[model samples]
Target: MSTATLINLVRNGGYQVRRRAVLTSRLLQDEKRPTAACYSSTSERRASRFDPDGSGRPTTWDTFGIWDNRIDEPILLPPSIKYGKPIPKVSLANVGCASHIGKRKENEDRFDYAQLTEDILYFAVYDGHGGAAAADFCDKYMEKYIKEFLAEEENLENVLNKAFLEINKAYERHAHLSADATLMNSGTTATVALLRDGIELVVASVGDSRALLCRKGKAMKLTIDHTPERKEEKDRIRKCGGFVAWNSLGQPHVNGRLAMTRSIGDLDLKNSGVIAQPETKRVQVKKGLLNRDSNIRTKGHHRYLMQVALPT
Candidate 1:
């Protein structure tokens, strides 16, 4: 398929994964032929995006098929994970981030937040490596899926998890389609937070973008960075037949390539334990600050605030 056609396929194929089996078959058989006539029949063209079970839609996520035996790793340029908006000098509830592009040519960071209700807000940050497609894909579609899942389940945690999974599934399917093949080489780290009534804060994180909560003038870290050097992450990668090595800078990387152990769309690295599942945490929000709360274990007035920074 032409690059345009592939990009179009990825653009239009969001979350519809049932036809992947047939898509692979077609790539192996038809992609090599010289003519547009390679796809012989109108029926075959119609079946390009299959509705396998006749419901005219993809089934649940378990059937999306993200795991495969193929790996075509590509060389990446210098990482530009650093980028932030100008500091707003406002409260965390109405926070402003300062982002600047470093020496690298491309900045692969994305951030957004939405206030759903007067008391409810959603915020997110993505740190992308390799390329921008994975991060862009999540930035484009995560909120929509979150809204859909939230409507069905009142639990915010379940909604966040389901949203991440659905976004990854959709991006993976797009990467492997006859078009948009270049997307596979790219992946990103995702960090999302939901704030309710400017009081409660819930965050879901994958990979190394950090989130910290400041309450009563003390800083309490809210999320863990998923670097490969972490014990559990190292052990998991080894179990998956992947190895870790440190770059000259003394930072450990999975398979000597990616520095993080978990992420949203590292398709080539999944067999090595890079996954999209977010480490989720919900902090109790008591309107009144205390000398100490059981959840935060600190003595202070109840003032919940956020501090978000890009990778150095």
Candidate 2:
């Protein structure tokens, strides 16, 4: 099997994206906190007590100690962030983001974007499972590795792939190396993109939080969901002695645990064929709205990748 697939979408094709119709809501449930990535610690389980088995680390931020380790506050962005430096006055744009708790007790979705320099930028979205620690850890530290790996002698693709893997290893089973991945029962999906000189776009992701681009009235999907139902993922899981099956209501689960097959953290499932390796892709944007474009967009209030309901 291919370890990774790379293509220049702008050159190979115009800007066509994989067109798949599915629910983003289903994706979010995998990040549900309190042990299993899917289902609430109480609600989803009592609703499905007849289900099989399966199942973040900590951060310096936890030192504040004013919070419950299990539940966390949602990242609520202010309107002030909508303003920033624009490339050209004619094409300048603003960025805006907001997070909503909705019916969930705490927000497991986390995101961050940083401008490395006048010509470079990085943006990432993380949907956390089991707990918010995985998202929090990756959100704070992945960029450090990305910057460190950028001094590489190879190319952008190699640099990004390695950077993602480095952090995955750093956070997975932290009982061995770092203090962050100790959240043995948690995991998080990452979708990251790097923009350079306003024309080059690079994206890497694990799990299903998607990256979508609307170009000239076309919806372009830049990432793939590493969900359990994917054939390759299923085969790998089974080969590793993990079983993939649908719950009574038709939701696919790996070893009856997580919905997505790839993510950072989730130490218990690593031996069962789960991995933190990400899918990396590059795009050359010879021409596009660089001055005003945002890194990614979420749909509705639940965010594009969040699940609306689970099988009972």
Candidate 3:
């Protein structure tokens, strides 16, 4: 697909959450290819202003927590019982991220990727609607909650499940304390991925933000969108005393309101089957893929695009 078409898809509410591309020597020779940074579909494309330092330039990389070089050490695991292949070390330096404000008056999307521990890496995206409050809250507290839950939970899946529910409750308390009634209606899509032991990838998601992995030039989807158009989601909403209605755009919505059936906030729809619980999935990265050059990038709204190309 053309890069412009991909950006439009994201702007139209379908995110290309995660993309992995393996760069062969031949692909690297193509100097005409764009860098991982974003370009606008219009004539006035500008660089993202996510500069962490006052360098007067767009940021290239951000280490969210204390930088630990030892975190780059690859895990030494015996050959997997099922695959009989040894896990390979993966470098965090190969990861890249970027974001743009898009067409919105204010950007409501928030994203963060960091080393959660010596053995785990965390990546998350929160797309807020109704307001930026929900997305902001997740951006600040999602990693904190995940780390806190990790102290008690051994399974990454359970850690994410608990973290999502806790974050919803925590946001409710925060809103209640702020005495802001409108905050209850604010909501965000949450898509989180955890990499453990360099090979296991566990993802938890609610709403429509997606995660995709490209292996050998093929796309592997990691999460499902939770929208009212889904039969299961629609049935659950109706079972919970809610009705689905289509808008002028022919898009299904819950009670003619939220387009998504599950989210982090949107407390007003809780009784109508809108939920904070996330569906989880787990996959293992092939050691061979990790040994090659890989790329990861996240999308904001269609008006904005971010790409991070990791050169081998």
Model 1 stretches with alpha carbons more than 4 Å out: 1-93, 117-119, 288-312
lDDT per residue for candidate 2 within 9-66, as digits (tens), equals 4434433332221333444555563464455455443311222222222234333332
Clashes of each: 13, 6, 3
Model 3 whole-model lDDT (C-alpha atoms): 0.75
Better of 1 and 2 by lDDT: 1
At residue 119, candidate 3 shows an lDDT of 72
| Candidate 3 clashing pairs, residues 3+ apart or interchain | 11-302, 36-307, 36-308
Candidates in order, TM-scores: namely 0.62, 0.62, 0.69
lDDT of candidate 2? 0.64
lDDT by residue for model 3 over 1-312, one digit each (tens)? Answer: 999998888876533233213344435555555554554657533443454443334555353232311233344454333345445454556565656675678878887888898778888888899898999999999999999999989999999999999999999899889878889889999888888766678989998877776555665777878999799999999999999999999999999999999999998999999999999999876653244324443443332222322222
The models' CA-based lDDT, in order, is 0.66, 0.64, 0.75
Residue ranges of candidate 3 with Cα displaced over 4 Å: 1-88, 288-312
TM-score result, candidate 2? 0.62
